[model samples]
Target: MTAHLSRRSLLGLVGAGAGAYLLSGCSGDDESSDPNAPQTINWWHIQNTEPMLPVWAAMAQEYRTAHSNVTIEIQPLENEAFKTKLTTATQAGSPPDLFQSWGGGVLRQQVDAGLVKDLTDDVQPWIGSLLPAALQPYTIDGRIYGIPFDVGMVGFWYNKDLFAKAGVTETPTTWAGVLDTVRKIKAAGIVPIALAGKDKWPAHNYWAYLAMRIGGLSALQQAAETKNFDTPDFVAAGERLKELVDLQPFQRGFLGAEYGSPDGQAATMGNGGAAMELMGQWAPSVQASSSTSKKGIGDKLGFFPFPVVDGGKGAGSEAFGGGNGFAIGKDAPASTVDFLASLLTVDNQRKAAQTGAVLPTVREAASGISDPNNKIVAENLASATGFQLYLDQAYPPAVGQQVNDSVAELIAGTKSPAQIVKDITTVAKSQ
Candidate 1:
């Protein structure tokens, strides 16, 4: 699910639990502080929903049953609220023992401030079990600071029936091919694409993915590092997107459309009103729920990776995405690492995958993925050579929102290719 930063918000029941202390603290060396001292781990995560929330509670209950000398306190918060509360807590130097982290500039700042634990050595033995792409964001300067539970990517979700109707016999493999397919679909009396202009985030993907395909991963990293996005590669990315926009491919009133509403982007694709949407791993489920029939396109739905640019430096296997992860706080008890180990075990990862809420970070748990579409994504993600975290999550909030807004304007014909990049550059430099 995308917005690793924005997939969900659901309430969960509270559970009280005791704990047993046996694991040693992984890092830091204050002589007087004992590694195995009895302690209560204050845990926080954003899986504030039925299957995950309860799964977490049961795991804590298991720890409580292990011994009488420890305690396990859990706090499950909705996504936005968790971010808000975490900001306040970290500002005060009291982050929970373990908590949700999307890992980027935010987590890097935490590490710089001594608020996060260094898990480089602690997770070494088991960390190799996770997909390297999933761990990319959590590894800072060659050291691990966080652990991923789930990972996913964005791709084009298309209706196979519509593609057949439009005579697109094969999925497009290049940007030019994508344009030709759109033309074919449109000429066949079908709306070629469904976009959520009102939401902005969905539109942001177009420009971002185009930038990736045209300029390669280093282009994005350089833009962030240099506080500039007005490079020729970025400009060409926007120009490429403008080509698509000029095709008049979107549904009427697309500028005002939402993403998951009954008459929005997902519904347009789900109901076969439009051919496809460039979205995240969560698209299919949301499409089903938003459709009038509540069954969506069903077996007619198929996904393809974003097409490559004809003369681009980027590899087709490079992807744009993000996922949910957990970071340890500097002062967390010794046993906290053990507790986390329990949560990420192969058995536990499989259980999480079974619930259909996550794509487990561990490879062995893949068989538990019941959703066929999710299985496809998980398969593709494993072979990905490089991954760019969702732009909104990778950049600071203001810069991220500016990319979303500027790109939306680009699609609306209110901003030019050069203008959007410059606009984003201004915000990035200011930040």
Candidate 2:
């Protein structure tokens, strides 16, 4: 339905720019008038791995072939490295022409600093081609600032064989049922959950989802606006998490586990060392790649949305996850915007989806998905009644990091649920 909207209707949703930046070789004027202008667009993205790495490179080459005078520079960096480099560049007032952005409070900070472009008018023509729900992460204060290439939600990726071995009949739909499932799996001599505790982010997912389920989707946004996380709902969320921790559900030495390493979370799940994991759409591919067999546990894998909590405010249909996208830097050439639009064409998006590396943001490109697990995630995301971006990406850097720290402490039994909320509130208010 979103793919058929007219440009006029889409343009009505665009918001005005907040401010302007003055940079050498950059102008607010339209440069499309000069068709032969030599332009080079600098792009930094995190698809440094095999499938997506080559896919993005091929797309750039195709674009270059069509426009002889234009040059597209691509720098593929690992996730953490990309974030560090981008931070330094932004602080130095020299951001890449186009760079990877998750688009939430961080983008809002950049927008306020006038380091990014206002793409309201530039993208309106084809913006409607993307699923409107996928656009929420990029829409800041009613204005668009980024273009999403992929979208998905967090859920349970489990081994069907392992479940049956544990005599678990149904996938869980409530908190109590999830605990029961974990207990059964542990009794069957299988680690219940594979978590990348050393990474901190993976462990934080549990607390974030619990908060969403207990307080409702709006709770985080309300806390962000008021700079207060010290509340009954938030503490209750942590308490619920503590109940899971009490079962010792994670793999042995999980606190030191990495996400993609041979002995880490995905590999553990892929090699059938663990019964399940709570992860995003990319989990399956990562699992396969990290496993010793390099083929993962193919048909043994299954997916289900995060289970609900009885008497909680959140619904089963609300989702919590974020995807990858590109943000326009302030000094980028005018042609940079056009290049970004070109990258999102249905054909290009389909190629990305075919790799099983991404869940396409373009509505029509959804058909390109070859894996059933990914298809299930896409369908659930499409039907979601509410959505929330990853908390680390949705909040300021300091506030986000504080959340990870506090939650980690809570998981380690070093802090109480109430203390964790207080720690988070102290950091959040300072931000």
Candidate 3:
């Protein structure tokens, strides 16, 4: 979940610097003793997974072995912490040699400030093999700036056990059916859906997906960029969410819920207090990380793309979510960039897929992975007529925060659909 930190807080975290940033996967290998060897390259990433770490570790080790001169220091900062650290490091002129970013506004800021290297020339050969949308977020004007890695979609996850108990056998495929199913699940004494509202970020996704399924992708893109949020199309999307809020599909007091910790709606799902969760393909990883919960959950968990709205303008199967990628800093050594480029090779992507549950941006590397969940997500993403980057990633940070806060208020009953549309428009125009 993305948290809105004050600029001061972000600055403080970033200023904490080397001690905080160097702890992720830094090793004590002393291969730097050779005076003629190239300098060590530091990589700042936010990935810390029990199952996925080994793949990255081996990748780094292999790169080092091949380059001999480039010793890459892989630092794994917590997601939120990484953002703060990155902001500070860049400001201090001590940023990592390469960094992992969602690569829209975040990287754009770095590019605008002349901190990131333009990789248009470097990334071209691999660009042809990537899905076009995966490259959209990282592209500025006409130049490519990052190497695509993990690509996935966001959708709905339901509890098969809860559905069975509610006497619902088939997954609903229409907007009205979604409401009816949630009502039935609630009547069976469970929270119809788990919402991480306090996190604000997850709640923001509700709007993104709603715009996709109800207002259509074009409408979503318009609201994402301009003061056009008050359009009939956008208001219609906001109304759908308002109807859900009135029906109580979300848990009681959900607006007060926290995420990225034990107190979130994800916890509620794990404990069976909720019947469904609306999240990305990464939901499986969350379940997999908890041993007891994983065993107890069994095959009861199921996933489906967001339901289509009757007569909606959008294609039903088009999905919304962003992927991760590797970006090079302006000061990165030539060898460091080469090593990072190799990690995106088909062979390494397939290997990474085995440890990490990522869908390779390259079609060939994706074919090498046999994980069922990965296959389902990859197929859905590939088949999607269009894809929406994460809502926050699609807009400027200030506008994204306003949208997030607006959604939280909408869910909390403090704002009306019309008001939200008006408010978002006012915010967009100011930016």
In order, candidate lDDTs are 0.80, 0.82, 0.70
Which scores higher on lDDT, 1 or 3?
1
- For model 1, residues 121-235, the per-residue Cα lDDT tens digits are 9988898898887887888899999999888888999999999998999999999999999999999999999997887888989899999999999999998899899999999
Each candidate's number of clashing pairs is: 2, 0, 1
In terms of TM-score, which candidate is stronger, 2 or 3? Answer: 2
User: Residue by residue across 1-431, what tens digits does model 2's lDDT show?
Assistant: 01111111000011111111112232224334354576777888776654566677778777777876666767766565677788899999889989999898888888988999989888999999998877887888889999999988899999999999999989999999999999999999989999878767777888999999999988998999999999998999999999999999999998887776668888899899999999888888778766788778999999999989999999989999988899999988767888899889999999999988789899889889999888889889878999999998999978887898888888888999999999999998888
lDDT of 1: 0.80
Q: What is the lDDT of residue 187 in candidate 2?
A: 98
- What is the lDDT ranking, best to worst? 2, 1, 3
Go through the candidates in order and give the C-alpha RMSD of each one to the true structure: 6.5, 8.4, 5.8
- Higher-lDDT candidate of 1 and 2: 2
lDDT of 2 at 416: 95
TM-score of each: 0.80, 0.90, 0.85
* Reference-based TM-score, model 2: 0.90
Query: Which candidate should be chosen as best, given TM-score against the real structure?
Result: 2
Candidate 1's C-alpha runs over 4 A off are 1-96, 251-264, 271-273, 289-295, 331-335, 396-398
